[model samples]
Target chain A: AQTVTQSQPEMSVQEAETVTLSCTYDTSESDYYLFWYKQPPSRQMILVIRQEAYKQQNATENRFSVNFQKAAKSFSLKISDSQLGDAAMYFCAYRSAFRGGSEKLVFGKGTKLTVNP
Target chain B: EAGVAQSPRYKIIEKRQSVAFWCNPISGHATLYWYQQILGQGPKLLIQFQNNGVVDDSQLPKDRFSAERLKGVDSTLKIQPAKLEDSAVYLCASSLRAPSNTGELFFGEGSRLTVL
Candidate 1:
């Protein structure tokens, strides 16, 4: 079974600054996908960014990026130019890249991020 | 494009009562999922359907929980004799697993359930 872990339960960042949320996972599969999802107080879960384990280059989407270290089993999310809208609970998820069968996402507990203006 | 839609944004029921949640996935999406999000925890998948066929339901509490996707477009999750611990948010999501797509999932505003 694959499990994702988010060590930081809470994080704080100042507006216009940057913050990194740490996540790690345990999986036996060689190739998989990592994702970061954001859930605002409205309880809407939205995908932030995704990284393929086979890709050496990190994934970047606007102000959101991921530092995926396959060897270390670490996938961290970086939020740049933090804004008040970034205040939400962030979840790290893992999914298998294999075609067919089950492909449900395994998510970590979550990291509640607070942006102070 | 319209995102996934869920009904009964909020539901409150007493323990041992029954509750149900409805979900309408995005059009043309081949896969649909039902997730349970307990307070302070990330959403955990309860059941998955691939175009009206059950794909995975290992984590679902079969004795108390039931779900169905009759026509592969809409789904429903029902909990009978709900337990207080079942109080949480039910999230519905859909994904397209086409050759050109990356299997990205689009989620809906979850239906919050409170079992008193």
Candidate 2:
């Protein structure tokens, strides 16, 4: 079974600064996908960014980017120019890329991020 | 376009009571999912359905939990004789799975449950 781990239970970042949330996973499949999801106080889970294991270049989406080290089984999310709206619980998730495999997502515990103004 | 819709934003029941949640997925989405999110924990998939057909429900606790998608659109999740540990947020999500689209699932606001 594949498992995801987010070591930091809580993190804090000042407005306009940057913060990185660490994640690691254990999986035997060579092809897989990693994602970062944000859950606000409203309990809505939103997608932040995603990375494909086969891609060497990190994925960047506006102020959200991911550092995916396929070799080290590490995938981290970096939030730049953090705003107060960024305060939420961030979760790291994984899914297999193989065709015909289950498409359900497996998620880590989560990291509570606080953006202080 | 309207996103996923869930009913009863909050529910409270004593242990051994029964509760149900309703979900309406995004229009044209073929996949729907139900997830359980415990406090301080990540969302865990409980059941998945492609249209009206069950795809994967291995993680769902069949003993007390049940879910169904009707006519491949709306869905309902029910818990009979609920337990204290079953108190959590129930999230409903949908996906089109377009090849060119990002691997993102549209989520609802979630229904918070409290079991005493």
Candidate 3:
């Protein structure tokens, strides 16, 4: 069984600054996918960024990026030039890539991010 | 493109009552998932369907919860004799492909449930 862990329960970042949310997972599969999702008060979950385990380079989307360390089973999200809209609960998710396997996504307890103005 | 659709945006029921939620996945999406998100926690997978067949439902409480995707297009999740612990937001998501493909899921605005 794969499990995700988000160690930071709450985090705050000043507007125009940067912040990072930490996440770790336990999985024996050699290939998989990692994702960071943002959920606002509306309760809609939105994809922030994604990283493939086979890729050495990190995935970046605008001000969002991920630091994926496969060996350490660590995948962290970094937000640059943070804005008030970035204030939300962030969750880390994982899924296996093995064919004909259980395709359920496992999620970690979220990190509440507060972007201060 | 229209995203995943879920109905009954909010539902309130007493313990031992019954509640049901409906979902319509995006057109051409073959994979659909139902997740439960308790307040202050991440979404947990309750069931997964590939077309009309269930791919995974290990986390679902079969004794009280039941879900079905008929015609491989629309889905419904029902809880009978609901409990306080079943009070959570039910989220429906869809994806174009399955395992071994890019992991991207489009989620619908969840249906919030309040069990008294």
Candidate 4:
């Protein structure tokens, strides 16, 4: 079984600044996928960014990026130019690449991010 | 494309009561998922369906929770004799099949269930 861990329980960033949320996972599978999801007060989960374990390069989307260290089993999310809209509960999720059709995400406890004006 | 849709945005029930949640997946999406999200916690997968058939439901509490996707389009999750621990937000999501595909999941605004 794979387990994801988000050590940071709460984080705060000033507007227009940058912040990073840490995540680690335990999985024996060599091929897998890592994702960062954001859940706002609306209770809608939105994809922030994703990283493929095989890829050495990190993934970046707009102001969201991931620092993926496969050897360390670490995948962290970085938000640049943070805005008030970035305030939410962020979650780290893992999925097996081998289980192509039956893949299910395993998520970690979330990190609550607060954006200060 | 229209996103996944869920009904009964909020539901409140007492312990030992029964409650149900409905979900409609996006058009052309072959995979649908149901997740439970407790406050301050990440979403947990409760069930998965592929084209009206069950794919995985290992974490579901079969003794009290049941879910079905009929016609591979719409799904429903039901909990009989709910417990206080059952209080959580139920989220529905849909995606294209194949695990390698990293297509963004479309999620509905979740149904908030409160068991008194």
Candidate 5:
């Protein structure tokens, strides 16, 4: 069984600043995928960024990026030039890539981010 | 492209009552998922379907919960004799088949349930 953990329950960042949310996971599989999703008050979950387990380079999308350390099983999300719209609950998810395996996504608790103006 | 669709944006029911939710996945998407999200927590997988067949239901409380996807396009999740713990937002999501595409899933605005 694979489990994801988000240690930070709440985080705050000033507008125009940067912040990071930490996440770790335990998995026996060597190949998998990691993702960060944002859930606003609307309750719609939106993808933020994704990182492949085999990739050494981190994944970046606009102001969102991930610091993926495979050896440590750590995948952290970084938000730069934070804005008020970034205030939301962020979830870290994992899925296995093995063929004919369970593809159910395992998610961490969440980190509620507040961006102050 | 139209995203996944879920009905009954909000539902309220008493304990021991029955409730159901409907979902329509994106066109051409072969995989569908149902997730339960408690307040202040992440979404938990309740069931996963691949083309009208269940791929995973290990975490689902089968004794009270039931879900089905017919014709590999539409899905429904039902809870009989609901409990207070069943109060949570139910999210529906869809994605392309795995191994052929990334594991990214498109989610619908969840259906909120309030069990009294």
Candidate 6:
């Protein structure tokens, strides 16, 4: 079984600043995928960024990036030049590459991010 | 491309009542998923379908929950005699195919269920 953990319950960042959300996971599978998802008050889950376990280089998308440390089983999300729109609940997710037919994402408890103006 | 669509943005039902949620996956997507998002928690996988076929439903409460994806395009998730613990936002997502093939997922605005 794969379990994702987001230790921070809440975080706050000033507008135009940077913030990092921490996440860790436990998985015996060598091949897997890590993802960061954002959910606003609208309740829509949106993809932020993703990292492949095999890739040594981190994944970056616009202002969102991931620090994936495969050996430490850590995958953290960094948001630069944060804006008010970045205020949301961020969730760390895990999925197995070896999933036979049905592949589903396993998510961790979310970190509530507040952007201060 | 049109994103995944879900219906009944909000639903309030009494415990022991029945409720159903619908989802329309993105065109050409062969995989669909249903998830439950509790307050302040991440979404949890409830069931998955691959082209109208059941894929993984290990976490689904078979005794009270059931889902179907007929024709592999639209899907429905139902809960009979709903419990208070079942009160959560139900999210629907779709992907191209296998996880290794399609790394991204498109999600719909979840249907929020409140069992009183």
Q: Model 4 fnat?
A: 0.72
lDDT of 5 by residue, B17-91 (tens): 999999999999999999999988889999999999999998899999999998999999999989999999999
Model 2, span A1-117: residue lDDT tens: 999999999999999999999999999999988999999997688999989888999999999998989989999999999999999999999988877677788999999999999
- Candidate 4, residues A1-117: lDDT per residue as tens digits? 899999999999999999999999999899988999998887678889988888899999999998999999999999999999999999899988886445778899999999999
What lDDT, from 0 to 1, does candidate 4 have?
0.91
lDDT of 6 at B90: 96
Q: Which is better, 1 or 6, measured by lDDT?
A: 1
Tens digits of lDDT, candidate 2, B1-116:
99999999999999999999999999989889999999989999999998899999999999999999989999999999899999999999998754533557889999999999
Cα misplacement distance, residue B2 of candidate 4 (Å): 0.6
Error of 1 at B47 (Å): 0.2
RMSD of each: 0.9, 1.2, 1.1, 1.3, 0.8, 1.3
Clashing pairs in 2: none
Best by DockQ: 5
Tell me how far candidate 4 lies from the true structure as C-alpha RMSD in angstroms.
1.3
Instruction: Place model 4 in a CAPRI quality band.
Output: medium
- Interface DockQ of each model: 0.77, 0.74, 0.80, 0.70, 0.84, 0.76
Question: Which runs in model 6 stand beyond 4 Å of their true positions?
Answer: A99-102
TM-score of chain B of each: 0.97, 0.96, 0.96, 0.95, 0.98, 0.96
Which parts of model 2 have CA positions greater than 4 angstroms off? B98-101
Candidate 3 per-residue C-alpha lDDT over B9-101 given as tens digits, one digit per residue, 9 for 90 to 100: 999999999999999999999999999999888899999999999999988999999999999999999999899999999999998775334
Candidate 1 residue-wise lDDT, B1-116, digit = tens: 89899999999999999999999999999899999999999899999999999999999999999999998899999999899999999999999864545857899999999999
DockQ-better candidate, 4 vs 6: 6
Tell me how far the alpha carbon of residue B30 in candidate 3 is from the true structure, in angstroms, after superposition. Answer: 0.7
Give per-residue lDDT, candidate 1, residue B20.
94
Pairs in clash, predicted candidate 6: none
Model 1 chain B is weakest, by summed lDDT over 10 consecutive residues, at B96-105
